[model samples]
Target: MIIEKCNICPHACGGTRYEDKTEGSLCALPALPKILKSHLSKNIEPGLIGSKGSGQIVFAGTVLNDSECSVFDSESDNKKSRINGKKLAQMFLTLQKQGAANINLINPTAFAHLIMEALREQPLQIPVVYSSHGFDSLETLKQLDGLIDIYVPFYKYHHTQIAQKFAEAPDYPAKAQIALLEMYRQVGGLASNYKKGIEQGLLIRHRVFPDFSRESIAALHWLSHYLPEGTGLSLLTGNPYLAWGEEAKNKQPLKREFERVKTALQDLQMNVGYIQDRETGEFFYLDEI
Candidate 1:
């Protein structure tokens, strides 16, 4: 799949993603899909991971120009060979046969077109999880409406200053809000099966930074007001390694702030997902009211 002018992400770089070359593209990645790695793992949120495991496929590079707080920043290593749609489809099939609960595509916005190509050729029996940095284009997401089953997009920041400071995208909050709402519209709320685990849904992730607890609460407030009931959420612990500038200087232990955030979640009556322990590195699934 070759794009004359790539409008895959919110950046709208208008680059040419030819099969052979990437011209003027912000990501500078080939049009063809390049995968950094693939394996069945239980590293994700518990609701998504079944007894077997989730088929985790890490795509190389990203359309978003986020320098900090990118979950898959290490995947930027472009040494991996490019694979066609057919090869990609086969990988899904292989993982499914190996008893994977679902196929999770990480950092896939740049390769969204290629993924559509792969899915069209051969649809999977298991659910397809669309995980990204939450800077998606509406057009690109619309193209993937029926193809994706579960959406695990990150909601990084509520403030433009923090977004700009970290991601260099001042419009990150606006773009992410629109993108996430659309995702929920496509897949209303999280649906789990007794045996299959996460059958389909939208599970938004937000990493609570130490000093930015208020910002985190504000974002949660917006989500509680807009998103439908039973919508899944994952409150992650911010990675200190990614902190920079003022944020790095003022960073503190996440436990105290997280307690406040948890109290806020209860106050908002938005307790229906997972919360990662900053110290223990464990995910506490919250099904309690």
Candidate 2:
């Protein structure tokens, strides 16, 4: 949807489009033509694989807001959710028949629990990868842990940094990361550096921002060393030329960088996964059954 003045994200500035119903603000609304396309499917890197495609669901909004809260913008479609989490959960159950084993949720709000409850009605043995601005609590993770098979936390720009950029919420990043750390403890890994959870694991994402991968890489490094095991990761070396689509742009990195990260994972023998560095299989959208 083309939002005239979008405030759905950490960037609260209104640009003068029209009002968006999902965002409830003219700024966060979608422009025409941009609202018609809903054909979207993203490939998991070589690391975070499931036998079937990830079961994706787009809910209303987010719990975390940031300057880099570009998750919603990546989807070319206006994810005008079908109202509450109950319907959203039913939607996923339907997709399960079509080979959607995992999930990549967009704009999942605090009401995500409602969706989880839907799944819990008859729990999934499969994983549900959550894509959102970083920051989630252990309690929240525990609530979701029952319903989710895997946790994929997307770490956005730092809270302090997002505050500087959007000037809407300064503490978002900190709160989100704090939640992330708690999440790591619950399902990712423990603080003692020795504890490990029985659940699957987390696939931490670091999308290359603007013209750099420093912050993203640093996040990976820090996450990798923290647990006794390594953290599965996907480094989006490519950025969508468009300001918000950066995360979805799939670019191959230099052979050296690819090997370097690959080697580190090998060293740790971390239960790690990543997008393949090979250029041949760099397919982004395809219907696989």
Candidate 3:
């Protein structure tokens, strides 16, 4: 995984991850800060939870990115400090110490390797889990030798501008996917998919963006053709809505498009997980320590 502080994704904010001992880049975060929370939480949806429980970690500070892209929420949820690899390692160490069987990493990328490395020799090691974004190197699928049971990578918006604004993709939904595929192949393939509780390995996850579910669906269709069968797949609904405010409220039409994505998921026979409502968006984390 490329951990160098970057300005590549949608947030062109050009964050300095290595500087000031930060763990993340523009997200105004570099690594897991003093953990605000960590605990075991269940998925309102069963398949989503492949392990006994998932350990959720929330860091402090609003991350500064390349283009100021905000995927989950906006300025309000902004955190405070930058996290570091070792610090992030410690955070996971805390979860392992507490007996968390799985982990749910949101917008993960910053110090992904560090956290996984920390899991290498723990008691309640992570066998199945989710990433906030897409996988960096599927080779970990091989390197870890399938030690990781489940993986859910995201292919958000297809438009270059959206990728420019929300992610750090220069080409987007194309070359970026190619790179992701190569890594997956290196690890295992569809057979590599696993669930800690039942099934496991490489799960592809995508969410509809404002007026961009079409673009996201295109990426999914491409996966259906390109991805090996039996690979784990999950489609998240509009609970993926961005942090709303003035700019967000004005774009009502985009919400309709997101709704279409939910409808499309309902119409499909794919093995997926859907967030039923905001009430079901329950998360478990070690908030303090």
Candidate 4:
């Protein structure tokens, strides 16, 4: 399946994505979805995985291309990993058979249509996670009503200026809010059991930048009010190496800035998920809410 006129994302680039070539698209990705990496990762939010780990598939390209994204090296990755729907379905089953708690589709917004085709190829017993950079189109998400089980999106920033600066998406905050609301309508808050892990849910992840605690706080406030009660959240410190240059990694201290975000979370009474310790870079689930 190829997107002749791509409108899968909010950008509405209206590109013709052929099976082998992409024309006039901002993402510069082909219609055929490409894989960056696939592995069983336990180092994710606990809500998504169990003892076995989540079957994480990192796809190439993104709707909102942030300069600070470190997920994949676009030039080196996906040279020979272009896969069709059947092949992608097979990969999903393979991971499920390998005892993956869930199939986590990372950065999959641009290829959502193809991914939907892959999902239709087979019946998966485990949950399907749609993880992305919170730039999803409501129309695209509406198409995925029954297909996806979990929505894991990064609520990157609250202000339009910050979003534009980082992702070149001036309308990101508004689009993300609407998309998140639709996601919650589909899946609601997290429902996890000891045996089955997460059944279905909406989990919001936020990365607190060292100098952007105020924006983080405002984003958190929006989440607290808009999302359902007890919606799972995952907080992490922004990577200075990605946001700033390599030299800034040592210079920028995240602990203090992280504390401010934590205070905001506490004040909002939105403490029901994972919080990464900035000092040691360790993630601990917050259960003291």
Full-model lDDT for every candidate = 0.81, 0.47, 0.48, 0.81
Writing each residue's lDDT as its tens digit, candidate 4 over 155-229 gives: 887999988877788999999999999999998887645124677888888877667788889999899988888
Q: Which candidate should be chosen as best, given TM-score against the real structure?
A: 4
* Residue-by-residue lDDT tens digits, candidate 3, 56-164: 6643333323222244333233454445555555666776566666555554444445556655644345544545455243333344444455555665555567665
* TM-score against native, each model: 0.91, 0.61, 0.63, 0.93
Model 4 alpha-carbon miss at residue 158, Å: 0.8
Clashes of each: 0, 27, 56, 0
lDDT of 1 at 5: 79
The residue pairs that clash in candidate 4, if any, are none
Q: Sort by TM-score, best first: what order?
A: 4, 1, 3, 2
Give stretches of model 3 more than 4 Å off: 1-36, 43-45, 48-52, 59-99, 121-130, 135-147, 165-168, 186-199, 240-289
User: Which of candidates 2 and 3 reaches a greater lDDT?
Assistant: 3
Off by over 4 Å in 4: 73-78, 192-196, 244-253
Error of 1 at 265 (Å): 1.2
**Regarding lDDT, does 1 or 3 come out ahead?**
1
**TM-score for model 3?**
0.63
Cα lDDT over the full model 3: 0.48
